[model samples]
Target: MKHLSYLNKYFLKYKWRILPGVLFVIISNIFGVVPAQVIRNAYDLIVENAAIYRLYEGFDRQAIVYDIFSYSLFFFGALILFLYLLRGLFLFFMRQTIILMSRHIEYDMKNEIYAHYQKLSLGFYRRNNTGDLMNRATEDVNRVRMYVGPAIMYAFNTTVLFLLVIYFMFSVNATLAIYALLPLPVLVLAIYYVNTIINQKSEKIQEQLSRLSSFVQERFSGIRVMKSYVREAHAQTIFAEESNAYKTNSMGLVKVQAFFYPTMLLLVGISTILTIYIGGEQVIDGAITPGNIAEFIVYVNQLTFPVTMLGWVTTLIQRAAASQKRINEFLQLQPDINSGSQEIDLNGNISFKNVSFTYADTGIEAIKEVSFEIKQGQFVAIIGKTGSGKSTLANLLMRMYDPSSGDILIEGQALDKIDLHSYRSQIGFVPQEVFLFSDSIKNNIAFGLDAVTDEQVNQAAKDAAVYQNIIGFEQQFETMLGERGITLSGGQKQRVSIARALIKSPQMLIFDDCLSAVDTKTEEEILSNLGKLMKGRTSVLIAHRISTIKNADKILVLDNGRIIEEGTHEELLNSGKAYAEMYQNQLLEEENV
Candidate 1:
């Protein structure tokens, strides 16, 4: 019930639809009861007593014809009219409510899931898979929608129909009705058992489905890597294993469901047989009228259908509940970093004061107590070997993850105090690996803004040295990039990413080895343009080569999550430390070439 309570707000919002649907159900049930009354009346009048034939004796022939026509017309016409009105109107409204509710629930659930994803720290995404998140956003939300619509409507209908049938049955013959319902307890217990199994199995099935989805997504995204390594067979074997696991779990659930429905029908069939035999005896003994026996049997049969439907509804509800729990858990996760009370005023200066960070999973500090400061309009460079925490430092500045201890300040305010969205808007990041959406180049470049003009997009492209490349294409800016911009080469993708960052016109720019893919000449040209771009902004460049950072105002050399050398390039070279060794090694390689 607590899990189901998540739907209460949506239910209230759409209660108008639900109310009409409920009214329709009630009207349908009332009309449904009329048929039972008609059966009883027909049995008593036409079968038991012979007085219905006496009306023809005293009537004129034409009048008798008229009377017969009227009687026949009234009985059949009324029955047909009520049946049509109840089934058509009631079913229509019920379907409409379900459709509306499903859409509303799907929209709201997806919105909430997306909002939660945005709030979560970067570490969460690092640990989770993109395909699993996509599944939650799409498939999981759809599961909730199914429950909001068909599952709720059918459950409500079954409950109301059952109660009405039971009421009518008891009214006809309490003793016999009670005897007929003797199997209900057993039926309910069986349904409960089936539902328990379904919930457990369905949860496992959903998990496996997520894994399979993740595998397919990863394989497709990394198809080139897989092919390059010739691991196609291995990938297929892994995918098949996941696919088989999903199939086995789904089939196991089906096996349980197979037994459940048959058991329910068998129990209900026995109960119906008992009702007829006992009711027939009572009728023969004159304890009950034939009409009463007929009505009781009709009502008992009515009860059976709802009971059967109720069992299926219970199973759906259990599966939906399990899905809801998984979705709700993700929705409930609190972001590790969020805006504090103080507001941010960006003047572009960034300061790291003894900052240290350790990822939750590894529990080893990725960045030690490193301190650094970049004044406004400074072009500072960070050079490091692999695993040197240079990228981690940039992540902290971007507020992707807060330091486990110590403070990072931008302008004069602590990073936490700044509104995350507003603060991030003022910063641009081009990661070591560039990611482009499958969209037009223009759209990708202008992604940060709500509205982008063609001129602004063109100018940004020109500034990033990608304008010539775009114009060379037939569609130019309108040309669609394939998935993750697969149509573009590495250098072209990097340039496009640079254009995207430049279009934001951020106050702080962090380029994490973004120029690594381009030739030295193009790199030099970009760096020159970037120098002009960084005139009134603070910039941090994370690079591997000496040429990339040699001209920076200050350079910090890092190794193993600690800064070993920090000074101007010439100062570091003269200091005769790790920086000199790296510079000399690169120079030696160049000379050999």
Candidate 2:
């Protein structure tokens, strides 16, 4: 309930509908109880008229009594039918108000969650899996919706119906009402015990299901790798293990649930028997009539569904509470990276002032006292071995993270102070691992822009050395890609990513080993094309190969999260240091190949 308090605002937001829905529940229950009273009156009328018919001796008197009984029965029956129909109409209105409000709240909540997901930092994603995130947004929200809609609706209905039925029963005979309701407390306790077990078991099953979903999604996404490794049998065995665990948990819940219905029916049966027995005693004592026994039975049965619903509603509330707790955990999170109010154009003069950063999740220092500068139009390249923090530098420049110590400036302005969206819009970043949506090649290339022409797409594709390959496809630029662009080869994926960056025509461009998949000749061609396009724009290239950055205005050699060498290509070649050795070793490797 503490966790569910977050929904109070939404309840208040739709109070108009909720209030009317509440009114309808009460009205329907009022009509609902009136039927039992109608039955009691009709029963009494028939008995009294039958007595009169028995006393009368003439055939005409008997026939008239029979007609009176028949007409009264018809009138009462029609009235009962009309009352039930009217009750059903109000129930319909109740659902229209409450259930419809739940749908609207669900939509708003999903959007809020998705929007919050986007606001979250990369670390949040790193610490959570996609499947759990998806389940919280979808499955959890749906559970909460059940609480808001059906559980709430049924709870109110049960309360109102119970009150009305009990009032009518007590009005007739207090002793009979008490005897009839004796079994209800035990039913509630049994339901409570069972629901607690169901709640615990349900959580376990939900967790296992999330794990199963994640395993399946990952396996399908990496099916190519699995096939190459021939691990289908192994994958199936693991999947079966997860599935068996899920089934075990589910069966545990089902076992407890198996007790739920039988206990409810048994208690209800006891209540009905008690009502008949007690009402008959009262009738024999002259405290009530035969019609009273009939009415008490109807009242007892009327309470049965609502009492059964008590258990169900409790389960729903528990599930909703659990889900809402999970949702609130994320909703309460404040993004580590906050966007600034300033929206300004970036000229792309970049400076890293003794910048140092450590990955919070891994606790690995990815940068250490790194200091460098790039003039607005100069091209700077960073070369490093594996784990040398080359990509970290690009991440810093893109403002994906802020430095643990010191600062970064863009156009002589603090990077974090610039509006994140506006700042990112001015820069083009191509990452080491390429990702493309399941969209057309043309749309993928022109992703960030509001509008683009085919000519622009073609030129960018040509510049990235992927135009010929795209043209070879049956649908050319219109060919829709598979997941992560599996339709393209690795080199084509990299080039398409490059084209996506190039199409932006940004003030700054950062390519983080984006050409790794292409051959040397194609890499050179793409670099040559980029040189022309990169004029008067600050460009930062992070790569492993020295050949990729040999012509840069400045080159920084990194090792173990520190810059060990800084010089021009010619100077580094003659320096007889780390850079020189790397270049000589790379040249020999090329020669050997």
Candidate 3:
């Protein structure tokens, strides 16, 4: 019952529909006893009046026997037909409403989890792998639905059916019914033992499946690397190891299921033997008629099937409970980031006041007590060697992460105090590793906009200097790309990414090394267009090429997580700082080439 509370939240919302379905299940099971009763009545009528004996002493056999027998057969026939027809209708409604309700629950659960994933902070994803989350969303959700559909429906059906059969069996011969059910305690123990083992194994099985899924996902995502390195054999060897683990867990579960069914059948066979042996003596002692013993056997047989089904129903419930627990834990995750409600009039004035941040996993500072200011509509460029905190600073400006030690300000208001969506909706950010959805060129360009036009997409592409390359394609704007735009050349992909950001016409744009893929000629062409894009808006450019940022209104040169150089390119060259050396070295390399 404690475990059921988690699943009930999904069920309670549909109680109105579910309650009626449950009522139908009960009615259907009660009607299931009709044919056996018809058989009992037909048998009793034949044996009691087969001949003119003491049992038929009062009735006139010659005059009334033929008419009475025909009437009896005809009435039972019509009654059995009507019972089954009505029962079938109830069964149909039961399946329709309850089974479909489980599907609705599955739909809601998957959507809720995906929405939660969207809300969760990046750190949460860092800790949990994609395959683990995907398994919970898909497979675990499906198992939970099984509980709401078949487990609940069949458990109710078996309970109602067993009760009705026992009541009728008692009326015919209580002693025989009790005698036949003597092995009931053993059956109960067997079910309990089997379900306990199944529940434990099911959790292990689910974990192994997730592991196998993760291995496949990681391998497929890096298949190009595997092929480049010729490590396909290594991948196969690792896959075989994971698959063997999954198979081992599956076999353990199968062994329990195999033991469970046979154990139930063996107990049922014992019940049948007891009924036949003891029922014969009862008939001889005149405690009950021969027809009464026959009815008792029919009731016991009927009860045995539902009793046997108990094992399967219990197995489903046990598996579902394990799955529900996993789902409940996922639903309970609280995102590390939360949105603030206050909206501010943003004017793109950015400031960082003694900001410092250390990643949670590694307590080494990524950005150390950095301070800077950029007035509205200024083109501020950040240049540093790899892992020198340039991208971290850009990410902070995007509000993807907050400063660990100090506050960031936008237009004199604290960055965290302003509404997250309001602030982010006005900023365009393109990361170092560009990602594009697998869609047509037009749709990919217009991704973040609520509504878009072919004119806007084409203009943005032209501005990013990729328009000629796009039109050269067979489908132009309608060309479909592969996953993550893998079909496009690296420079083409970067330009498309720039186009995606530019179409938004954001108040501020953060380009985190976005031009790394293009040659210097193409970089110069794109930078010329970017000058127009940045004229009246704040821009933050992070690049390795000094030529890219040399024309900026201001450049901040970072070294070892500290802003050691700042001012115009001319000022840094005269000062002979780290920036000047990087510029001189690039010239020397070009001359040597």
Candidate 4:
């Protein structure tokens, strides 16, 4: 119950549907034994003298028996027909209500997990892989649904019918009832032992499945690498290894189930055989009537199946419990970052005061006492060597991750004091690795806008200098891109990402070398267009090429984790330090060409 406590609200919300469904299940199981009950009456009529003395008063005794048998057969037939009709109707209600309720709850649980996953911090995502999280949201939620739907209903049905059948069997003949249950203790012990094994195996199988999914996800994402390196065979081997591991674990679990189910069935067979032998002897010795023996047989037949289903119900419970434990591991996690209560409009005045950060897992500092400022409507560039924390700095400003030390201020207010949503609404980001949905070019461009018209999309594309290229395609704006913009060239993808951010028209736009993919001519054309767009807005650029940031109003040169130089492009070159050397190297390469 504690493992499933997260779902208490949903259970309570749908109790109206569940209660009536359970009532239907109860009524169905109760009357399910009616056919067996009437079997006893049919036997009694044949085995004993007819009690209707008036009807046979002037008739032969055999004739009277014949008439009694005929009428009894009709009565039993009609009762069975009616009971079966009732059973079918009740089953319909149960399925429609309880099973349907599970589906609704299943839908809610997926939404619940998905919504919570959205709220979870970036750190949470960094800690968990996509495939594992996907497993929890989809497969694990389905396992929980099994516990509520068929397992709960059938478990309840088994218990109630078992009790009623036992009561009837004992009343008919106590000795016969006791003999029929001789294997009960053995079966219980076997179930306990087998379920323990199943529990361990079920969890292992789920883990292996997640790993297989993750392996495939990673390989597909890096398929270009695999193909370019001619390592397709190697990738196949890796996939086979993961798939084999999953299959082996699955087969092991199936083997356990294979042996356990038949053993339980054998026990049920013994129970049936014992009732037939003992009840037949009792009828011969006159300890009980033939009707009682007949009734005992029907009750034993009815009881054996629910008992057999106990093993399956137990398996379902264990699987659900295992899935619940896995799901709870994430559902109970508290995000590292929580939203602030204050709501403030931003004017893009940003200041990083003694800001520093160290990744929690690595314990290595990315930024060390680095401080900078960007006034409204300014165009600033960050230049650095590889692994020099340029992208990390941009990430901190985006609030994807927070600085470990010192504060960032927006318009004189502490960054944490402003509502996160409001602060983010004022900034648009195009990351180094551009991403686009598998959708039309127009939809990708207008991705972040609340309500954007086609004119807005076209304008943003034009501003990105990609409008002509897009229209050159067969579908123009309606042209579809594959996963991660696979159908588009690298330059086109970067421009589309730029268009997506530009469509938002935020006060501050951060471009993390998004123009790196384009040639020098196209980059110049985009930068010229961007200059006009940045007339009254702030822009931050992180780049490697000197030409990209040479016209920036201010440039910060980072070496290792420290800011080594800061100035306008000309002032940096005049300083004859790191920035000057970088400019000279670029000039030498161009001249050499």
Best-performing candidate as measured by TM-score: 2
lDDT of 4 by residue, 208-230 (tens): 88888878887888888889999
| 484-544: candidate 2 lDDT, tens digit per residue | 9999999999999999999999889999998888999999999999899988888899988
Cα displacement (Å) at residue 5, model 3 = 2.3
Error of 3 at 447 (Å): 0.4
Per-residue lDDT for 229-345 in model 3, tens only?
999999999999999999999999988998888888888889889988898999899987777767777777887778878888887888888887887777888876677888876
Q: Estimate each model's TM-score.
A: 0.95, 0.98, 0.95, 0.96
Show pairs that collide, candidate 3: none
Clashing pairs in 2: none
Alpha carbon lDDT of each predicted model: 0.84, 0.91, 0.86, 0.87
In Å, residue 285's CA in model 2 sits off its true spot by 0.7
Best by lDDT: 2
Query: What number of clashing residue pairs does each candidate have, in the order they appear?
Result: 0, 0, 0, 0
Give the range where candidate 2 is weakest over 10 consecutive residues by summed lDDT. Answer: 194-203
What TM value does model 1 have? 0.95
Find the number of clashing residue pairs for candidate 3: 0
